[model samples]
Target: MPHAKTTPFAMPLPDALAHVDRVFGIGTILADEGQDIVAPYYVQSEPGYKRVHSEKGCMHMALNTDGVYTADGYFTQIREVADQIRQVQATRVLELGSGMGFNTIALAPDHGQVTFTGLDLMAHHVSTARNDAGHLPNASFRQGSYTEIPEDLRGADVVFGFETLCYAADLDAVADQIAAALAPGGRFVMYDGFRRADFAAAPQDVQTAARLFEVTTAVTNGFHTIEAWDAALRRAGLVVLRSQDLTDASIAGLRYLHNRSARFFRSWKYRLLRHVMPKYLIRNAVAGLVGPYMIEGAGPRSGDTMGAITYSVLVVEKPR
Candidate 1:
């Protein structure tokens, strides 16, 4: 993407304000109760999906089948994740970007004696999750950045992130922190999107779409490819055990979002807001409310069909 043309003077009112608002909105929405995780604005897909999984799509397909959130079967997938943690016999586990602690609450009981420490960047998310998991004595939530896992929190047997690592401006440092936090032979499992190694080789339209997705979603470094992620892990003293591309199955989420956004965009409220709201507020609102859908739309175009992006699950281990 070409650099934006800047004037010799400071940026104008709403433009500068819009930029700040967008950034702040992205950071704060985790705690926004108005957004429902059950029907998250940013709908997520499971690990494996056929062209059409069900009447509603992979999400419903997973839900009806007792599937974990955006993952495969509930029992089987959770068993696998638990088993991976069990491999090291992790009594204490750390989850980065724990969001509302839904995943932690869902998976904690299955592990019996294992304890889960959920960390998120938003304090409200932490408090809300704490309340949500009040019954789960083994699960706890705190606010913190993924870039630096606190010293006291280090030495966890496993560290996992679910679609959260993309927010890191320094993935290498994040990886290093995870490595430092893990016990020898500890595991790190992540489910997120990555740019293809040959993403640059994709068509111009696809390239632009990918860039827009990053900009819209406020991703620090945006999507990464397996090669880049693998290199980062290796540099941080972690070994990549598995990287499974799920781009095809994940397209359903994007398709669902695009359709959903189409209806909302045509609504009178949205129309009024677009034209009547101040430029900064409008930009911030779009970035918070609609930007995710726009970014989701780009997924299939850049990932599933264009081969420029891949949504994948990664399993890595720290050397013993």
Candidate 2:
């Protein structure tokens, strides 16, 4: 895959922004098997994702099944997440990029005996998560870069690195940081997108133009094959517990919901970007590009093609 033409000039270059750990673990995550992977999207700046995920319509797909914002469904989904975590028996668990702290709230009961730390890269996200954590007694919010998170995370019973990895340029460091932060016997729960089983004709501009929809940038470094992600996890001293191809299930579901919720899919939120910014420059423009895609007139770059459920999810564990 071709690297981005323009490298970001930020302190923790997007590559380094993965997780803020000063030191790295000794073992390496191995991609012994070669699998061609592609990150579904890109972003020129952080605003790229904030605009779309924060939006009312397009956001449901990103947050609900993808693990972005709080669920619009009900406590059942939250319970499902808790079931996954409780089974792990994580005493000190940390979620890497908790957007609105929904997961934190959902897992609040677990935190009664479980110490949870929710870390986020965005300021508003941290503030909102902190506000969400305000009522919780065990959880705390921290405003820090993933690149330098402290060693306190080293022995966590459950360490999660969800789809948020896609935003990092260097997945190696991301893996290193996660491994270093894990408890010797803890499990590393990972859920990410996978490559399509067959090659779909892609636009040469898929990499560049896709950045127009920045929300995809946060969880997916790019669309990767299950094999590629599997290899990375193994290399980092973690073993795959269970993984399955959910591509078909997710795609089918998104298409169903999208069609069913077509009205909300184009709600007034679609036309209100100008109120927030100049509308020409910023994520609004990207949202405009994504609008048509979500509206059913997809020209290959449609919503069905670029969502979280589009890929498979996995659960990997760090052995004692």
Candidate 3:
């Protein structure tokens, strides 16, 4: 229920669940841990945001959907929400914060007769995204949370949840659990963290405290503007089709993914594994100055914290 400026953390969520179970498997917990998630501030905030946005801007190493992303190759805004959910060829689909499964294997082979589910709340990353959905076959996985409402996702048809609804503190109970699990007039695509005007002309308030003031994860940011997601989609009955502004194409593909993630973090094989790998360290100076302040300078970036992508992405509809 953390809203009204959520900054409250007494510290410690890492018992590391048996060190994330005797050192991850399931391809390094859904595809590499990216330096044990930047060494602290609970891996850059919000109850370990499912392995930090599924390996923060997964440079397409997110189980190959024809890979390539150095961050902000947000799989081309998840391929325009998988071509509008494969032109609604959906039968049953659901995803709500299925991080580390990278859009549940990039929207599960384009709705393989749907029936794809993936919920999450650190149920061990939904048991490592069901072992990274290996054989795929009408995928399945659940850990529950959207305040737990299963019943075969009611009438599911389409419901993808990106950027995990700004770590929902309760956006009208997660938009009434995506309008009671769609299917009546299903449709619910997403993208999160909206509040623009160039992120309120950046005077710094995008927080997640370790000691940079504080505000770990939203308690209230239901699409902070875009007229607050059209008044939270008419108070969760949903009905907004086609909405885009991939925030200036995600700030020009995060400027070509912060210059190819600073040449893959200064390659010489990752600076010789950050110099003789002590587990390729990271003590976060704002995610190591966010790939060298967005690829080595052009000035004023208000000292990078991944320069907040300022967002919006919608398909929404649910009221037959």
Candidate 4:
């Protein structure tokens, strides 16, 4: 069962689904006619993502290794981000959208000199992360949006997020906010998926899937293409230090998700529920959790390359 906190919503479907269906080559469902799907809350806070992490006390979207569902793989992502922070000798680190404090708690003990402060949008997530990181004195968490960096939170030596910025309603706003929060020469590192620059030029089927993935993932306006990312960073007056496409490396974990979804869909319990529950509910359940992954493949694929999106690591530095 999904985590109890991961509540499902049946909002009036917005006009976005048709575009999604057209992009991904899927037929429109009757579910889109009246009540559509929407997740007003954070995607990481969703049942599927949260339930898995609640079991092991860590939640992250990036894969640590091929076929590795363990928290270790997630930690590998944390370590990479942490390593980047360390290289720049940042003593004050801010993690925007630090869901459940997994990254904060994981990196705090290892680098005691660097104070890790996590800011999240959900109060519940703040509480949960604080409880999880209670033993780590170097770690702290607060409830807030990354788009609006409070004055006192400014001047961080390093700021980062893993698949978090996609929650922003305005990527440009987020870029500007990060720039304002960091000290001169401070670094900002992000690991997230982005649409390809030529996504619109992709084959019709790929375009539909890309749109579907965006709507289903609740990142419709927030998911930026790589080209958009560069422009946004530069516009915010931050210099791009490095941008590495980790799409291939991230595929293993995605494949694992596909396998898991296949198992769940094939389960006898789910089969029985199909007849017992309302069709819309089932559709919402799958659309909320499974559909995004299906369109995106097991991992990141370029918009024109057949996958819904591609993942990348972008490191930028504020001018001194």
Candidate 5:
């Protein structure tokens, strides 16, 4: 893989903090309760995600393996899911928090023999996904929460969630649900931002950036550590197959969004629009700008590599 030309955390920690404070009152950002905000946040953020993230309705970060950001990078997680489907010869696939059905819809057409069901907390998201997937008879979406996978949806050969598991209020509970939902020998895959094991030891600014990113993105309580997830999954009797940090692969895409978000802060017109836009929607800029810092720490000039969060993939299996 080629190295990213754009460096992570190119913006100094102090500068990033000040920018966040200016764009969103620091106190207001900190005061957000984060409770019951997931559905509303997605509802408010749908338009922005469509316009900025991907018109195809991807609600997750792009993984730019080639060191350059492109719309195609959004397919990285989908590609991984496809690989798992093939590996397991998955006849039934279940996606948790399947926002807009991007991954399922993308995979359904190619895997005509597979049946894909997406469950999301928001009806609007399910409706949107269902509408987008109307042409694909193999794909279907319904409004539901991963906290309780429907009995009929259980026994999936492949279960995956992209960036949505962070909103899980109870990791152990969700893990149990996932484990139960999968058949023996089935694979469970997830890609999301995680708190590093040593997150507490990271610099204060980096921690702040991570919190801001989490809250702004509706992960209000903060992201769970990879260690926590590993333990939770294991306790639920799932065997961990892979736990790899892919933060570096995410830099190019983060930088791309950061630069785009920076434009809002740099110009008065964009700043003015923040007042009129939905609070949660406009705050996405704050998340976009500080995302790299949370993952990569202070800039190259400072030589600080102490990061508080990581973008990672976790794959587990229910033993046969």
Candidate 6:
């Protein structure tokens, strides 16, 4: 079992595939065409996100900067949002897909003068976030999708979504909405998984791993490339300020999840529990197990360093 020392994955790509196949056959990993599974997926996966991912209710990836996994890694996206707030001197912030109000709640207390609004598609998530944010007068949560931001919520100084935009069905429509929602000179930040520009050229196994990761997490249509997002934003009359690949920083946390998910496949007890659990919830293990392989390529043995997907940050701004 050879490993890629450059990556945080412990098992080789072939071994990882075997583990996933043992639990959920690889042939059955993809969703049927035009399936509306995102909302239900989140509903079923909330508990898992709270327990396995973060107790604070973070549903996004933990970004480790020094190649070490730590609880602080969860705050990486938060810090980026906070920096944008200060940079823009923002008084109003809107977070798209603000799951459980993690980002808004964390920033509201420190910026007392700033008002924070978090919009999510899940009513359960909004209810939970509202409960969690009861103490913060400056923060509020609403149940809504980013595809059609409400008219009253427009003119925000900062608009961001952490690991949520990948669920977007139409990039052009969402980009237009974001541009319309932001005030002049306002910033829009998104952190999520994206297909590499050369995704079609990647190995078949790597492509399969990327698609498996997408379907398990309910991104049934698949991740759009960064280039597609950038072009869409520009067409909507926004400036693309940054598009940084943070895949290296995500390795440690992804590997941690991969190892944890591997346990469910290796143990008879955990495997049995899958029958009792919600199908979407139990299938999360498939995403966690294949996540690292999709982003880090098969392994050193394959001599393929070009991965099929990347975790990245894209920043754009509405013109003044």
- Candidate No. with top lDDT: 5
Q: How accurate locally, in lDDT, is each candidate?
A: 0.57, 0.47, 0.49, 0.64, 0.89, 0.88
Error of 1 at 273 (Å): 4.7
What is the TM-score of each predicted model, taking all chains together?
A: 0.68, 0.61, 0.29, 0.77, 0.97, 0.96
Q: What does candidate 4's lDDT look like per residue over 237-282, in tens digits?
A: 9999999876655544544443444444446775465566543333
lDDT per residue, candidate 6, 255-314, as tens digits? Answer: 888889888877899999878999889999988888888888887667876689999999
Per-residue error for 31 in candidate 4, Å, reads: 8.2
Native-structure RMSD, model 1 = 11.5
- Ranking of models by lDDT: 5, 6, 4, 1, 3, 2
What are the clashing pairs of model 5?
none
lDDT of 1 by residue, 1-320 (tens): 21111111122222322343443343343234222232222222111111233221121212112111233432333454687877888988998877666667778888769888999876656876788788888998988877878898888888888767766567688888989999888898887767778778765544544544454444435576767778898999898999886554444344333333344344566546546543332332332233222223323323423435667778999898
- Per TM-score, the best of the predicted structures is 5
Q: Higher TM-score: candidate 5 or 6? A: 5
**Model 3 lDDT, residue 235, Cα:** 92
Candidate 2, 1-320: lDDT as tens digits:
21111111111112111111111110111121122222112223234434533321112233234322233532332343465567777678887766656666667765588888878776766776787678788888776655666776667777665555545555566767787887776666655544433324433233222223333223223455567667777888887888765343233223333332233223457335435543223322333333222212233322323322234456677777
Candidate 5 accuracy as TM-score: 0.97
Residue 53, model 3: Cα distance from true site in angstroms: 9.6
Winner on lDDT (3 vs 5): 5
In candidate 5, what are the lDDT values of residues 15-115, reduced to their tens digit?
87897788788778878756667767888999999999878799899898787888888999999999999999999999999989888999999999999
Where's the lowest-lDDT run of ten residues in candidate 1?
1-10
Q: Which scores higher on TM-score, 2 or 5? A: 5
Instruction: Give me the runs in candidate 6 sitting further than 4 Å from their true place.
Output: 1-8
Deviation in Å, model 5, residue 34 alpha carbon: 4.8
**Displacement of the residue 156 alpha carbon in candidate 1, Å:** 1.5
